[model samples]
Target: MTCRLCKRDCQLKNSHIIPEFLYRSLYDEKHRFYRISVEESEKSTFIQKGVREYLLCGDCEQRLSKYERYASTVLQGGVELTVSRDGNLIHIEGIDYVKFKLFSLSILWRSSISSLDIFKQVSLGPHEEKLRKMILAEDAGRDCEYPFIMSPITHEGALQKDLIIQPTKTKLEGHVVYRFTFGGIFWVFVVSGHRIPSVVVSASISTNGKLTMLPREITEMKYISNMATELARKGKV
Candidate 1:
């Protein structure tokens, strides 16, 4: 494959739907449902494939995949981040942590904008409202179990989110707040459409060798790729 952005003989690249490391044990580690109301689909066809992609070659994926552990301490609680798209910037809002939790909490996707949602059957774990609050407050060092929350931060969204993260105190539970800073994928999803193609899940190749059902990550690179192709078609990422 050719590089989706540079078109320089695209090689497989590291595709991060959301970095695996940031969530730590908090990771879902399993499948779940996220629901999206049909308000955004009135004008287009709904994508049936999962959303996500590979921006790395096999070797690159292997190398970058190991870095997730280094940044586990960067995010916690509700977060608000933003992604500024050039042409891909559709109508959207600044990041909202509460909305992110709501969107990510359940994994059902529906055309209805109400409580109609579902997920694959599964067991459960203890609630982490306290841990969630700790992460928001940026208090990882107090545990001594995991430290060094810097160094491996990754970029996200069209604006290249790593460029815009700053620390702020945000409320998570009642009277509970987190002090974590925003970096990497922090604000990108907040600005993207939740009612539309809300939560991106996975990415993979189509049988025809083209990429399909890609999440916001692959779509970002491919959006740039598609634009360049159009320029050749239009003589003009």
Candidate 2:
């Protein structure tokens, strides 16, 4: 079979649609994580690993893994970041722009190309090819091309880890965006050909290795609250 990322005819590896490290915090005592899906009648389920498919060859997998490793370090606090706060907003600096930006783009591109049911909500259409080329060239592209907003989520004052939600796509400020939750962080990836919203651009990681995160509680998000309520009603959480 041909590899998806490099388009090479070779033996493909079981590549994860979402990097494996993202699921580490979600693992339970049995080394599994609960996957919650509002669209499914089951509501909640357990899995030993993140979603995977035969997408890339060993070489291509390693290439993408490099970016994933960098991202894991940053997200897991392995990298030194200069941090300051203004109200609830947290500004962070000292990031590797190329590595982190490519990592973010890789996730978006992978989800769009993935055939998994969980990622069905993400379909990049024409943007898919553009991203493929960019990733292949290791071009992070401009900040506004595929901007994303990230916020760490909390439940009542406590950081909420151990939860993974199915991605959902929606329109925000006249742009297409996909929402994902994992590692106690909410990600809103804006994928559009037109000019992205200023809010998204400002929140996205800057070329100077700066980023802003809006720390939020679950109660402020009605959709998340509703999902929690439904899961509780089903005795799943």
Predicted candidate 1 versus true structure: per-residue lDDT over 40-150, tens digit per residue:
332222332232355434553343343333223213423233323335322223323222232222111111111212111111112233323333333322211111111
> What's the true lDDT of residue 150 in model 2?
92
Per candidate, the number of residue pairs that clash is 32, 0
Global CA lDDT computed for model 1: 0.27
lDDT of each: 0.27, 0.87
Instruction: List runs of model 1 lying over 4 Å from the truth.
Output: 4-14, 21-30, 35-39, 42-50, 73-237
Worst 10 residues of 2 by lDDT: 36-45
What is the per-residue lDDT of model 2 for residues 1-237, given as tens digits with 9 covering 90 to 100? 998888989999999988999888878899988777655465567889888999999999999999999998888878888999999999999999889998988888899999888889999999999999999999988888888899999987787866678788899978889999877899999998898868779999988899999988888987688778876777776
Which prediction has the highest TM-score against the true structure?
A: 2
lDDT of 2 at 230: 76
